[model samples]
Target: MPRIAYFGPQGTFTEQAARTFGDADLVAVETVPLVLAAVRSGEVDSGCVPIENSVGGAVTATMDALAEDEPLIAVAECVLPVRFSILVRPGTRAEDVKTVASHPHALTQVHDWIAANLPNATPVASTSTSSAAVLVQDGEFDAAVCAPVAVTHYSLETLATDVADVDNAVTRFLLVSRPTRVPEPTGADRTSLAVVIAHAEPGSLASTLSELALRGINLTRIESRPLRGQIGEYRFYLDLDGHIGEERVAGALAALHRNSNQVRFLGSYPKADQSPSVPSAKNTDDDYQAARDWVRRMREGR
Candidate 1:
């Protein structure tokens, strides 16, 4: 059985995503680092880690792991809607609760509700939302800010539903593995690369980016990091449409050499199926639909 790891303490969303993405039999862990460690140590075949959230922005921990962790390649990605709910021990009611605990991100998501409804209750950080749910299940915490799935997983009661600050809260997670499998292309494909440009050349970035635009290639994402050193040299991680095998993506990479001192193609896997990007329209209905559409796309990729 292939084992998959995620930030888990039995009820976390990461664990739910792992199970949702994989068949039964994979194991989950408690921290993001453990996911990498498990894969690197041959304890697991693959792992899932959050990359970004629509509401909260980037997950720096996973980004750093991707930046430095070797012997692992991003093989797949999935987006999970960041829907949260207030959970309590079985038979517990909302008014009776004194305190509520959750991860920092989840705590922030339901901040207003915590202040207004449970004013005197102290906020506690309990590792992850799922961990919070697990903690509540153990009867230690009065309530927990957790996912709907976590409530079910821990047999907890839901006091409030869909407590995210925004209606379209979502998170993207990438499944990574050691020695990524190179599947033969079936039309749609995407590639991820980590590029580091020579710091001495000021013009490197302009050329690095323009080269692709000059080639008429559309970049999906460009993320940068400063190399740990005296002055300032940075590593850029890029995601581009299409496989590296394709002529355009390949040519774009070749053109990148003129400006980039180092380039690493992280992986070129089957591209995730995505719908056409919705345009910004002029009304509340359109806006709502757009949010719903984006949330749908985010969940679809997952």
Candidate 2:
């Protein structure tokens, strides 16, 4: 059985995502770095960790790890519905709760609920929501805002269910492994890249993005993080709507390479939602191939 590492003590959203990645021997690590390190060191076959949430935005731990000097590559993407609950030790009444503990993202997800209901409860951060549940199990906390699954894991009781302020809360997770193990791209795939501009100029961001637009590549997400040790310098993380294997995507990346200082090819994997059908157009792969062939013919003649 494959040994998969996940950000967990168990029962966190990352564990749920690991399950979505398929059956495996799950190893629960305390932090995102541990999970990635396990994979990089060959201690595990793969690592699964949250990358983004619809409500709270990107999970910087996972994103920064990918951007850093790790020889890992994302192999798959898993998205899971996240539901938070106010869990407490059995026999702990809701009225007796004076503190709420959970992962920071989980805390923010249910902020309004906690404020409206627990009003004066002190909110504490834990490594993971399941860790918060463990705290309650050890009598360290009065209650925890964690996944419903965490209740059973730590023998806690749910004081409230679906406590998240947003009913549509979802967390996106990425399965990462060695660079040699990249997954074959589906036509309806997403290519992730960590791009650093050659200079921090006014139009640098726009110029880098224009390469994608010029090739008709649609951007699904773009986020910037400060470069380490470089004040006023930023690196962009992008998710664009095409596999790296596609012609237009390859062309765009080639252009980006010429325009940027460094372009880290994160990985290309199937989008969580399968490719939607085009009205009356050929499949993207066929179109890309035909277009490439035509362009090659024109270049050869020239």
Candidate 3:
């Protein structure tokens, strides 16, 4: 069985995502960076880490880690619905809770729920939701706001279930491995990239984006992170709706390479939702092939 490391203490949402990703020898690690490091060092076959949350937005740690160090690529992804449960020692009542511990993001998601339900309880931040349960298990906290799956790993009872400030929130997780042969392109796919513009002048970023726009490529997401030690400089992380093997995607990437000082191909993998991308008539594969053939004929004096 392939080994997988995840941002976990065994019961966090990332672990749940790892399970969804594949049947692997799942190893629980402390943080996102550690997970990627293990992958870089070949300590595991792959690492699973949360990348984006619908309620809280990008997980910066994962993004920055991916952009830095030896390159790693996401081979698969899993999206889990965000849900929190207040877990406590058996026989503990809601009124008995004085302090509730959870990861910062989890705390933020369940902030309002805790206020209305356990007004007297103070919120403490733990490294992760599963670790919060560990705290509660060790008598450090009165309750833990964690995923329902955490209860299976700890001797805790659920005081409340399905708690969240927003309905239908989901978190996206990536299964990353050291750079290798990319997965075969599925019709429904996503390509991730990290790009640093060649120039900081006006229209530089727009010029880079136009390459994709001209090819009819659809960008699913874009986030800017400050470049390390480069004051005011930023790296743009992108997710576009196609695999790297596609013609338009490859063309856009080639253009991006020419237009940017740095372009890191993160990976091209199947999208978790499996939604197919329908290309416009002008940008279809046949259109590109015909254009290439016509150019060849012109060169041959046809």
Candidate 4:
């Protein structure tokens, strides 16, 4: 069985995402950087880490890690609904809680719930939700806001279940590995890229994106991260609605490469929701091929 490293001490949402990779030797690592480093160093075949959450937007650590060092590619992805549980030692009453611990993102999602329910408890941040549960298990904290699976791993009772401040909150996780054979395009796919525009001037970024817009590609997400040590410069991470293998997508990527100062192909894989993109008649694969053929014929004096 292939070994996979995940951002965890186990019982994290990332662990749930890693399990979706089917049967594999799952190794729990401390942080997202460590997970990707394991993949880069050949310590594991792949690494699973949270990329973004519906409530909190992008996970900056994961985004920045992906854009730096030896390139790693996301081979697969999983999206899990964000529902937290407040776990405490058996027999602990809600009023007795003084400190509630969780990951920063988890703390944000459950902030309102915590305030309304455990108003006296101070919220504390931990490296991971499961780690928070570990602290609670060790009697370091009064309660832990963690994934439901955490209760099974730690000796804790659920004080509250199915907790979330917002409805339909979800987190997206990526199964990344060192660049290898790209996954064959599944009609319902997503391609991720990191691009740096050649200039910071207005319209420069828009002009670069026009490459995709002109080809009728749909962008699902775009985020800007400041470039390390390069004052005033930034890197843009983009998630588009098609695979790199598709003609229009390939054309757009080629254009981006030519226009941008740097273009990094993160990966192209099936979207977690498996929803296919709806392309217009003028931008379909056949349309692109026809355009290519017309240019060839003109050059051939046909």
Give the alpha carbon lDDT tens digit for every residue of 124-156 in model 2: 999878778888888898999887777667788
The list of candidate 1 runs beyond 4 A from truth reads 115-122, 186-188, 257-259, 270-273, 276-302
Displacement of residue 192 (Cα, Å) in model 4 is 0.2
TM-score of each: 0.81, 0.84, 0.93, 0.91
Poorly placed runs, candidate 4 (over 4 Å): 91-99, 115-127, 200-202
> Candidate 1's C-alpha lDDT?
0.73
For residue 88, give model 2's deviation from the true position in Å: 3.0
Q: Give me the displacement of residue 55 in model 1, in angstroms.
A: 3.0
Residue pairs in collision within model 4: none
User: What are the Cα lDDT values of the candidates?
Assistant: 0.73, 0.82, 0.90, 0.91
Q: Determine the C-alpha RMSD for candidate 2 after optimal superposition of all C-alphas.
A: 3.3
Clashing pairs in 3: none
Model 4 lDDT tens row, 1-302: 99999998899888888999989999999889999999999999999999998877899999999999999998899999999999999999989999999999899999999999998899999988988999999999999999987898988999999999998999999999999989778899999999986445678798878888888888999999989888777899999999888888988999889877888999999999999876656887898889989999999999
Model 3, 187-289: lDDT tens per residue?
8999999998634567878987898899989999999987988875779999999988888998999988877778899999989999997776688788899
Better of 1 and 2 by TM-score: 2
